[model samples]
Target: MKTYTCQCGTPLFFGNRQCVECGLDAGWCDVCSETAAVSPEGTCVSCGTSVVPCANRTTYDVCNCFVDASLAEPGTLCRSCGMTTMVPDTSLPANVRRWALLEAAKRRLLYDFRTVGYPDDQLTALPPLAFRFLSDTPDKHVVTGHANGVITINTSEADPVHRESTRQQFGEPHRTLIGHMRHETGHFFWMREIEGRRDAEATRLFGDADANPYAETMKQYYEQGPPEDWNEQFISTYAASHPWEDFAETYAFYLDMRAVLDTLRWNAPEQVQDLGDDLPSMLATYCSAGIVLNEINRTMGLTDLVPEVVPPAVVSKLQFVHDVFESLRTGVVSQS
Candidate 1:
């Protein structure tokens, strides 16, 4: 994402709630499509428009985006917070922090999702898109997944200790709350754009999701593990478990590429100056930038920022993903 400027001429960031230099409040002005200073009464300093700060700021301190004043009521939610249908029980202080972390990740995920031009309207049984942040209970165990347009994420993933342990258990190079959000939304969009719309093409590209028995596939995957040559054809080993997973995994990779490209454009324009819509150019530029980014992380003694290598077969799956996003951009769905 591009940097924003405060009224004080200090640089602001996507997650900034207040300008550190001037102490003036900062908010995401949806109308202006950038973070800007907002008055105490919720006036946009940049555009001189009226907006409503999301209630999550006052109630939970988890949001910084402003809602359009015209569409807002007494306690209106911003576009990002409004989609969160449920959150963890916040009576406990720990739960509140966990909810905060998940909300931050969700906002980032939705920001990138809408940035890619997908509409917020629902194409499934669930009204628009909803999220459920939950913790495991003795009677009801919650696994992170999507169904009928609703995405459920285990609240435990918010804690670094828990997330890193789970990542190592799965032998994942990287696992993150935003990664969970993107991967689950991939399933959400598959239901929206491809389940019945382009099943034939998706089957040819991945496999027949309907033909594969999902539960049995999951069971067998754990027992036998992924094929020894999984990396040759899949973006991740878990992606080789099922066709739906393959699509979601490849779709997540597509989002990761677009996000990195978007970041490079704003923060390092010279690197991606000639990048265009072509897949080859995108892959070339992305891999090129990844090498530099990964090395930078190594210098800091951190995990490689971008670990997965997009292989030839995975490229085919990503081609399918790109087509879906393009269709959404050009066809029925309009950007907000």
Candidate 2:
């Protein structure tokens, strides 16, 4: 995660409503590529209204969610906030804190999405994206990942202990708010790329999405183990279940590299900074930087935090994903 400083030089929270040193208002706006200057009235392009100020502003630290409605016509709510199809049942006893944690983590996810050039309404001028946050039983509400242009987040994920336990059970090396964003956005991109564009063709290349995504296949896998040689190609054993899973994992891997490259470009000296903006150069930089990060983690008595290696087969898949985004960025691919 990148550190942000207020214009006044005081460090501010990622979702800060006001800067302490200069009294300037600020909120992260990914489209603008900087911390947006929040108008004193609390208006911002991201949220479209003045944030509700903390009642205990003097005593407690909190992120600002202000929006100023009076200054001008209200824009849609912030991209992440707007996607909330459901909030936790506030009426329930233990839900209030859970909801708060979910919202806070969500803001961090949105920050990553916007910063990494994924489309948010603020960046694309599209209709607001939507999301649902709900609770369910382990037997009843299986959270199958899918994106039909809208997102659904199981509210249980808000529990830190539950998330950490699942991370350990799954043997995942890294997991966090930003990691979820990278993973789910993979589903979102699949919806964008596969929708109405030769679905049959994709099925031939990828696989049949028509297969019951929620099926006994997963139950069988959990009881048994992933197929043999799963590690030879797939990032995780679960990814080998279906092609859609493959695409999502592959997309997440590409996002990991993309963000690493951006961090490199920001930190490198100007003399060596002009690496060509192509998949090969970016991939090379990602590998080089990844080695340094791995070594540093070991120095600190931690394991290689990102254990997955990018083999040749995975690199080919990543290049296809990168080329698709490059075409989108350059307008070489028409939206129609």
Best by TM-score: 1
Residue 226 of model 2: what lDDT?
A: 78
lDDT per residue, candidate 2, 125-180, as tens digits?
34345556667755768472555556566766767788889889987787665566
Which candidate achieves the best lDDT against the true structure?
1
Predict model 2's lDDT versus the native.
0.61
Candidate 2 Cα outliers beyond 4 Å, as residue runs = 1-5, 11-13, 17-25, 29-33, 37-76, 91-94, 119-128, 137-144, 198-205, 208-216, 267-275, 301-303, 334-336
User: Candidates' TM-scores?
Assistant: 0.95, 0.76
True lDDT of residue 198, candidate 1 = 87
Q: Candidate 1's residue-wise lDDT over 1-336, tens digit each? A: 778898889998989989998888897887777889987777888888888778887788888888778987877888777778888778888888998888888888877876677755543345457899998878988899998889999999998999999999999988999899889999988888888888788899899887889999889999999999999999999999999898888998888888899889888899999998867899899999999999999999999988998889998888878877877777843221
RMSD, every candidate, angstroms? 2.7, 5.0
